[model samples]
Target: MTTLRPERYSATAIALHWAIALLLLFQIGLGWALEDLPKGAAQFAGYQFHKSVGITILLLSLVRLAVRLFRPRPEPVKDGRAQMLLASAVHGLLYAVMIGGPITGWIIVSTAKVRLQTMLFGKIPWPDLPVGQGFHEPAEVLHGALGTIGIILIGLHVAGALYHHFKREDVIGRMLPGAMKSHGVIGIAALVAIALGIGALICGRLLSFAPANLVTPPIPLPSASSEGDIAAPMESTAPEEPTAVVSESAVSSATATPWKLEKGGRLAFTAEYNGEAIKGSFSRWDATIVFDPEDLPGSSISVTIDLASVESGDSQRDDMLRSDSFFAVGTHPTAQFVSSSIRAAGEGRYVAKGTLLLHGQRKPLTVRFSLNIDGSRATASGNATLQRLAFGVGEAEWSATDQLRDAVGVDFNLKAVKKAR
Candidate 1:
């Protein structure tokens, strides 16, 4: 009697099998890492990488399935019909999950409502599906459930191969390369990989369940100022040192003179949360302006905002806003704006080109306003658009633009008294 050799899988099939297996292992670990990261640029980058790998897995799985369908496979070892049927079911489920997991994740991204671009591995661009919001939660649930099912099916598949190989059968040899002889070694490695993957998933879930506010102390806001009261002027009149310079326009019809902020002035901002607009104001801020409607070239203005003096009506929200996630009051307690140039927009209307420094980031800003001077009393009303993210005003989970619009509308109704010559 002559001993028979087992038929091995085609070279292409074997290559794809191992390639996808390694990628799947990497993806499982990446997903676990993504969930445990804090909600910031790092976490965002992690998501992008995870999405890229998931999509790669999806494409590879499709290719493998196509090859499996058109190409011939090695014959099954001599085994009972019941065992063969069980093996077929397990393999079928594995294939289904390999394809379905990425699709479900894609669906979640498609319906997320957040305007996040999918940059595959930070290089290739990937488009979201046509699905809209409302499917995100459901798709997330299904994807997670399928992940659990995939783990189980993988265990069964590995166990079946080991059972046959240990029983002196040719089951594992069918998929192994011709040079490989020991199926037991490969089976044990696969088992270890699966164990490590499960452990990572468990640890990730525990971290996700931990409270976000536990590590950091609550941020404190400055005490509110007395209502309807104006801050008394300092007895000294020496000019305070300026942070930045403003270019003086050529003297024109407008006069250039100093003006001081008086009682009844307000600087407020509006931000949107969950699609609802919320308004807030700073009770303590100072403005220094040297302006003349005719002398546009010799005009300048600078404003300093006390971040801790912010009042948004709701104390809880205000505290959160001052936390490390938003203003980080302890690190940056003030926001400043200095005009670089002032140009007349229209009749009594003007635009101030300037730089705004907030949360340690400085960016160019423009304020459009109308000015009316009535002798010593002057009134100026203006509005400007501020991008919160540009200045790192919101970090972590608050970084999501969908939850809070990046653009905040800042409006000021300033009352000023001109300094006597």
Candidate 2:
């Protein structure tokens, strides 16, 4: 009058168990693949996939735990107390890692100094844990340690399963999809070997890789003189006091005598991060200048810079600069500088009082430059110091001046030819 207890796992339990297992193996490979990839878009993508799979395993593990609590399971095989306890210990540790691994990973990302937003599979937004920077180091150490522990536990689990299947012929079928009676030891062993081989190959390649192209050329620092042209280098001299704020409407774009911007110019910036200098530059930009050294009142200059073109030698750092935490190029793709007035600072030096619009914020900027005019060409070289935080260039933890300094020095060298009037 009563139903009998099944000799194997329920269909639901079997499905969750195998699903989590396969994902875990794939996740391990992905983690290794990240190390093989260059520190650019490829590595970033691999990390995202790893995160997605980790989250998936975490969810599935929870479901499996719930099923274990509610659903009936198979009876233990008639192994001795010591062997049984050992088997139980391995299963318990496996579950711990299946759940703890993802939790620790999540913690690492959440408390990261950069504070980047986590997007699961690039679609669903995952929120960070409301933990402080203090937790970041501990979580990172634990996450890596757990990964090593998980690998060991997985090997033990597989060996134990194979032992039961081949020697005692008792408990192996309980979690198998079909509850089949037997599997060829050779076939199982070959599959295990292939997986291990692939894993080893990935690790080897990652360890041996030396990225030759990863080294981006250092930003060219302005020099005192170049060729026969009189090129002035960046001077520590400060510009004169600011004049009236330049209104957007008052900044005239149409200069009577416009100087065409020639190629071979550089616009670069330098900032300190963690006591190390980070130098980078914008590859694309346009400028409009109307100036007759004699007519200072009518002179005006405007520059449009592509924010997405920032290159800092490091691809990962470049990506971070483009993200919302820095330039937010998606929202503000370009930055602008409009001059309100220009005045002579020295015999060959000039200061252009203007406003710089960056990261959707506007702030006053003074550009101190040296101009040397030839028959039909002019070469100008100078530098400006900008407070990045004033324009919201760095958000979250980056807003702190200690790590990435607030004062970013901008250096520029421009060459132009007078228009044929």
Candidate 3:
């Protein structure tokens, strides 16, 4: 019992409406598809897309609602009052729910306090909103709940449409596009939707990569106590000549305190992948240390660790990680970190910038460590986050869309005591 004319909708209107709807459905599918992915780069990218698309859907839905509102459409007088009210309510709820869902997601992502960037393949960056970190947990809860509810709402809408088409069949023809009546029109629109969908997927993949587009190369931020709070760059402004001097005063008395590795030292380390935390320990570590507080500036250091003694207690992970694929223990066993510059980060902490020769890839990195001295021993322990690809490890498992990042949370907790000379 349809009274309205069966004329076609404006091409622009129809195109926009279908495009938005299809995208929303695709987003839901993506969310579910990636729900259990391991948490490093791939998951980070997924969540980034989820949040960005959520925001996009919310905005587009609002615009569509407004169009439906200010731009009046002819009413179907033949449809029952129940049908009209139901449709109105459903659309109204969809608009409201879609808008709220992404806002909650954005707040949650902001609050996670994870300074993670989203890069798939293309170069899209997710803009972070100003966040008050204390509310992270609350925001996360709302984000999860609202998204679930919104999905349910969307599912109901689709289910109802199918019910009308298959079960009720009272007015399936009304909701169907006018193009459905013409074989030619139907084929063309179908072709168009498919083409557009494919083109968008390609664009979506192409638009998510973020490079190290840093405005400023990350330097050691100044401490409150540093004179004039100057950020000393790692590289000296003055070029080094081959004739750098080794003074008699520098050679004979470079280090006031004796330097040698301490016994019974412990170093604990932890790694984070995709949100899960994994820990490891190195009980036997040798370090040469100097503790003349006045000669702290001239102090140099080296650490030699036993590759044979690494045990995070999980043999499977330990063995697999130690294999040729990861560390390649049989050929090149031990991992060494040698430090050159030991600058005070203040607050009893120090940033050691040096080369971490891991898996034979010597990458320059800054390892920040804390110090404590008791009678004969001092220890420095902290963690650094770096991309795994930088060191040329784990090559087989990399993809732009589903990549596992090498920038894991590599941490340390070292305990060292001086050995009797």
Superposition error at 193 for model 3 (Å):
9.4
Tens digits of per-residue lDDT for model 3, 1-421: 7445334444555555676766765665566655664432333345556666777786787777676665535443344788767766776777766676666667665655333333222245555568788777886676566546656666566555555544534333343465375444544554565566545544544443232220112122111110111112223223321211233466356543543434444555555555566677654445545444445555545555544345776645655555445655434445655555567777666665555566776666555666666556555555566655655555565322134544555555445445443
The Cα local distance difference test for each model comes to: 0.67, 0.68, 0.52
Model 2, 20-41: lDDT tens digits are 7767766665666665676543
lDDT of 1 by residue, 19-97 (tens): 7766766666567666667543334445666788889989999999998887877777668999999999998988888
Q: TM-score for each prediction?
A: 0.49, 0.54, 0.42
Stretch of 10 with least lDDT, candidate 2: 221-230
2 against 3, candidate with superior lDDT: 2
Number of the top TM-score candidate: 2
RMSD in angstroms between candidate 2 and the native structure over all alpha carbons = 10.7
Q: Deviation in angstroms for 95 in model 1?
A: 1.0
Task: Say which prediction, candidate 1 or candidate 2, comes out ahead on lDDT.
Answer: 2
Candidate 1 weakest ten by summed lDDT: 222-231
Ten contiguous residues with the weakest lDDT in model 3 = 221-230
